[model samples]
Target: MKKLSFSLLAMLGFFAIVFVSCKDDDNGDPAPLTPTIASITPSSGPVGTSVTIAGTNFGDSPSVSFGTTSATVASGSTATSITTTVPAGLSAGDVNVTVTAGGETSAASTFEVTEGTAPDVTTVVDTVVALEDLSSLETAVVAAGLDDDLAGDGPFTIFAPNNEAFDSLIANLDVADLTAVVAALGGANALAGVLQAHVVADSLPADLIAAQDYPTLNAASTITITVEGDNVFANGAQVIGEQIIADNGVIHVIDSVINVEAPAVDPGEPNVVRVVASPDGLGAAETNWTADNTYILDGFIFVNDGQTLNIEAGTIIKGRPGQAARASALIVAAGGTINATGTAADPIIFTGEADDLNGSVPDDANALWGGVIILGNAPTNNNDVGGVKSVEGVPTEEGRGQYGGTDATENSGTFTYVSIRHGGSLIGANNEINGLTLGGVGSGTTINNVEIWSNLDDGIELFGGTVNVSNLVVSYSGDDGIDIDEGYTGNIQKAVVWHTGSTIISTDPRGMELDGGDGPNETAMPFTTPNLANITLFYDDVDGSNLTDAFVMRDNYGGSLYNSIAFNHDAPIDLERLTTLGESSYDRYTAGDIVISGNILFNINGVTDAANFADLFEISNEGDAALETEVETALAAANMVVDPGFGTGATKFTPTADAVTDLDSDDDGTDDELPEGVQNLGYKGAVDPAATEPYFANWTKTWAVISQ
Candidate 1:
C-alpha cells in the first residue's frame, strides 16, 4: 500500500512539473510587431528608377513584398524601408505594396504602375501641331507661322492670355485670328518681334525680377518696377496665373491679354524708390521726412537677406501682386525690420495690388506678383539615400531645413498690424514657395498680428524655421493654410482658417518634412514637432483631394493638437495612405504615426464602407477606438459651417453669426489664456506652454491670393 501511494505522488509531481513548463513556454517569447509597407514616391515610375519606400517595422525587414513580387535588400536593412525594381507585367495604377520582416508579413500600401511619362498636351501646342479644327485659339496659332517656332528647340517663356482676356481685346482691336493680326502688322517675323518683346529670354523668375529693372527679349525696352504692393508687372500688364511647363519652355498666363505699348517712362526716372513703410507715429529717434513719391507696403517687405525695413500703424500700404508685399508677408530672415504699428481707429490696411484690366485703364499684367522671400543662411535636407552626389530635381547641398546661425539675434523683424494679400504660387518644377515662407528662420524672429488674404499655396509654409507666429488669419488658399516642413520647431496658435482646403496640412511623413529628401524611410528621418491650439480649421473640399483639411499628416512627425475643430474633409479623416511602405518591425513605426485628440470632425461626405476606406480605418484604428472618432465628430458638428461668408461685398473671414472662436483672442490683445487642459499654446521645443495669447483682429477676413 505504501509503495502504491508513493507511485501516485511521483506521478502527480511529474504532472505539476509539465504544467509549469508549458506555462513558461507560452510566455517566454515576446509578441512580434507586425510591420507593413506604406508608400512609394513617384506614385508611378518606370522600373529602373530607384524608389523610396516609407513604412513601419522596417527595422525588421528581411525582405519586402510587392504583390507576388519579392526583393532582397542590397543595403539599408531597415525593416520599415526597402528599394526594389518593378517587375515587367505589373498593370498600370496602384498595386498592393507590402513588405516582410521579423518573420512577419505587413499590411500593403498602394503602388502606382508606370506610365511612359507625364501627359504632354496643351491648348497652344495641340492647336499648332495637331491642327485641331476646334478651339479658336488653336486656329489662330496655325494662322500664325509661329507654330513651328513654338515646336522649335530652344526653351522660351510665353506669356499666354486666355480666350476671354483676348476676347475683351477683340472688341477694341479689329482682328479675326492671330494670323490676321500678325499679317496686318507685317508678317511672321513682325509677330515674332512682338512676341520677343514680351518673352523673357532667360528664366527670369518673379523673385529675380522683384530685385531690379529687367530687360526682356526686346533689346531696348526695360520694365521699371515700383513695388507698392507685392505685384509683378510686365510693361504694366497684370500677369495672372498658370505655368504651362513643358520640357522645352514655360508659359505665364496674363489677364486682359497683351498689347505692345510705349514704356511707362521714356528714360525711367532716377530709380529712387521711396519705401514709405513707416506709420504716422514717429519718435524723436525717427524723422518724418516727407517725400513726393511713396511706395506704401501693405505687409512686411523683405528685399535681400541682409536688409531692414521699418513700419508703423495707419500705414495705408498697398497689397500688389507686383511690388506691394502679400498680406502677412514677413521678411523673417536676411535681417530685416518691419515696424508696423496700427491703432483701432486707423488700423494698418493692406489692399491687393490688382489693376483695372478693363479698357477703362491701361494696367500692367504682371501687376500683382507675390510675397517676399528672405534667403537666410541655413541648411536644407535634400539628399538621396545611397549617399549619392546629388538629387535629381532639388538643389544639391541645400542641406536639410535647419536653424542655428551665428547671430542668434538675426532680426527678421516684427509685424504687429500687418496684412498681406494675394500671395504664393508655383516657383518651379516642384519648386514653388508659399505665402509667408520663413526660410531657415530662427526662433528670435518676431512675428505677430499678421493676416494673409487669398494665397495660391499654403497661407504660411514654415521651411525649417524657428519663428513663432500667432494671430494668423488665412482666407482662401489654393492648398494647405499652414504647413511646417523641414523641422520647423516653431509655435503657431490662435489661427483660424475657413476655406475649402486643408488647415494644418502635412505632406510626406513630416508634418515637418525632413531636411534630407530621403532618409532610411519615415522612421529614420529626423523631424521636430511644433505646438498648436485654439484653432478652427473649416475644410469643405473632400474627395481625398488636398483642397481642404483641418490637417493632413504626410511623411513627417511630432506635435500636439488641442481644442481644435475639423469639419467636412470630404473623405476619411486621414489622407495618409493607411500602410507603411518600407518594412515592418519593432524598431520603426508605420507611416500613419500620429496622436490625435480633443478635436471634432464632421462627415458631410457619405460614411465609409466595409471593403474600402472604412476598412483601412478599421485596420489602423484597431482595438475599438470609437471614443476618439466620437470626439472628432462632435467637434465638427459644433464648429464646422458652410459658406464661410465669402459673399460679393462682405467676403472672407466675415465673422459668422455665432462663432466664439472669433472672440477667442479679441480681448486679451497681447496675451489670451486657454482653458485648463489646453496647456502648450504653440509648437514648443520640448516645453510646456504657460499661457495663451489673444488672436489678431479680423481673423476671418478674405485676403487676396494668386488665383487670377
Candidate 2:
C-alpha cells in the first residue's frame, strides 16, 4: 500500500515537471530587435542611385518597404541596415522601414523618401587621346601602331615627338616608303600602342612639371619635360593645344613626335685612348661607359664665355688608372659651358681602372684618377692664400669664368646628372686633391645633380667658387665627403651624405673652414652668411673615425639649415667656434648668426652626453627658447639607419687555406688581413660585409693602429 502511494506521488511530480518544462520552451517573447538607422549619403536617393546604408543589425534579406508599397530588397544582412533603389512614384514623405531576419521582423522605422532629381554628369575623365595638334605625332603613332591602344581603357603617357622629332627619328631609317607609316605598324594592333605612347596614364596638368622627374608606363621610358622660358614641351614637342575634352582621356596638342632609341651595332675596337677623348667621334660611347657621373673624351673641348661645355647624360670618360694619363681626365678652361648631367643610375663616371675590374691595389690603382672642373666668376683660396677668409659675400675668383658672353643670361651650362667616383688620387697621400675641386666656379655654373662616390680623398673640396647645387650625393670617401675651406657660397638642398670616415675632418680651422671659424676675419663673413639647407647625413664610423659633431658651426660659419637630419654618429650636433679670430671686423661673426631651425638630430651611437659620448653638440644657447626649439626640431627629424643594407657583423678575408681565423671584427675587419704566417698585407677596410670587402679605408694607417 505504501509503495503504491509513492508511485502515485512520483507520477504527479513527473506531470508537474513536464508542465513546467513546456512553459519554459514557450519563449513567445521575440528577441528585442534593436533598431539603428545610419544615414544614407543622399536622403533623396535618385531612382537609380546606388546608395550605401550605414547602421547595425541589418540581417540578411531584410524586407525594406517604402510606405505601403513593397520595394524590391537589394541587400539586407543586418537588422539596422537595408539598401533598396528608390521605386518609381515616390514622393517627399516619411517612409516606414522594417527589417525581417530569421522568420522575424523588426518594428517599423522611419526613412525620408523625397522627390528625386535628374542625374547629372560632372566633369568627364579622359583616358588616352593624344592632342591632335602635334605636327608629326600622328605619323609616328601610326607607324608604331599605337592608335588602338589609345582608344582602349587606358590613360597612357606618350613622349610625343614633334615634326622635327619625327625627322630626327626617321633620319637614319632606311625604309623609303614613309607614307605607309600606319600600314608598316602591323595594322590596328600597333596603332593602339603607337597612340598609347603619346599618353601618360595620369593626366599631368602642364603646370606641375618644373625640373622634376615623373614616372611613365612605357618600359624603361619616361616623358622628358623641358620648360624653357615658359615654353613647355614633351619630347621636344610644343604643347599647341591642351585640356581637350574626350571620353577616353585628355588630349594636349604637341608640335613634335617622340622616338625610341634603336639598337646600334658596334664597330670594331680601335685605340682606347682616342675612344676616351673623341668618344662621339668614333661611335656612340654611350654604351658600356667606363666612368661614373662623368664623361671622358679624346676630342678637343671648346668653351666660350656664356657658352657651356655641357656633357650630356650617361657620359663616361675613363682616366688611365694604370697608364700614364691617369692624373687628369677633363680640363675645362675658365669659360665655356659645363653641363655634365648624370643620373644616379647612370652617373657620368670617370675612373682609372677598367669598368668592371677592381680598383688598383695599394700604391697602384688608387682611384685611377680623373675629375671635373668648371671655372666661373668666383674667388679662390689656392695654396698661395695668406690666411683663410670667410666665403660669405666674397665674390670668389671668377677668373676664367663667364666664358659665354658678357651677358650672364646667355651663360649656360648644366651638370644636373654627374658622379665623379674614384677621382681624387694621391699625388701623394698627404697632399691628395678632392673629387670636384672648383678653382673658380661661379654662380652661373649649373652644379646640381653632382655626386662623388668612393673617392680616395674628399668628395668635393672646393678651393674657391660660388656654385649652387641641389640633390648632391657623396658617399664612402677616404677623406671627408665635402671640405669647403675657401669661400663657397652655394645653396645645397636634398643633399645626402653617407660617410664611413670623417664627414668633415678639417686639418686646420685656421684654413678658413666654415666648420671651425669661417668668417671674413674676426667678423666672420662681414654681413653675409653662406647657407646650407635640407642637409642630411648618415655616417658609419669605421677605423680611424674622425670625430664630427654632425656640423661644427664655428665663429664665421653662418648658414641656414632647414628641416635637416643627422643619424648614426659619435656626436650628432655641435655649434661652436674652434679657433680664435683676429681683431679685425671679421670677428663680428658669431655662432648666433646661423639661423638653424626646422632641423632634427638623432644620435644612434648610444651616447647621451659629450663626456659619455665621444662627441655631441658642445655649444649652448643659455636657455634661449628659439635656439632650443631649432635644436629640438633638428633632433626630431634625425634617426639612425641601423641596417646599412650591408650584411651585419664580421666580413670575410682573402685566404684560401684551412685557417680558423675569424672573418669579422668589432671594427668591420676581415679575417684575411689577420696576422697569420703570411706577411702583413695589412688591414683592408671592408665597409660592406656582403660584397668583397672594398679597400675603402687607408688600410695601412688603420693596420698600424690595430698593430699597436
- Expressed as tens digits, the lDDT of each residue in 96-193 for candidate 1 is 76766667777777766653121111112111222122233334444543444443332323221222112112212234344454443344332221
Span of ten consecutive residues with least summed lDDT in model 1: 118-127
Off by over 4 Å in 2: 1-268, 271-308, 322-326, 343-346, 357-366, 379-412, 501-528, 542-547, 572-592, 604-615, 619-708
Best by TM-score: 1
User: In each prediction, how many residue pairs overlap at the backbone (N, C-alpha, C within less than 3 A)?
Assistant: 115, 115
CA-lDDT, candidates in order: 0.41, 0.41
RMSD of 2: 28.4
**Model 2 per-residue lDDT tens digits across residues 178-243:** 234333323333332223333332334332221111112243345555444423444443332232
**True lDDT of residue 687, candidate 1:** 13
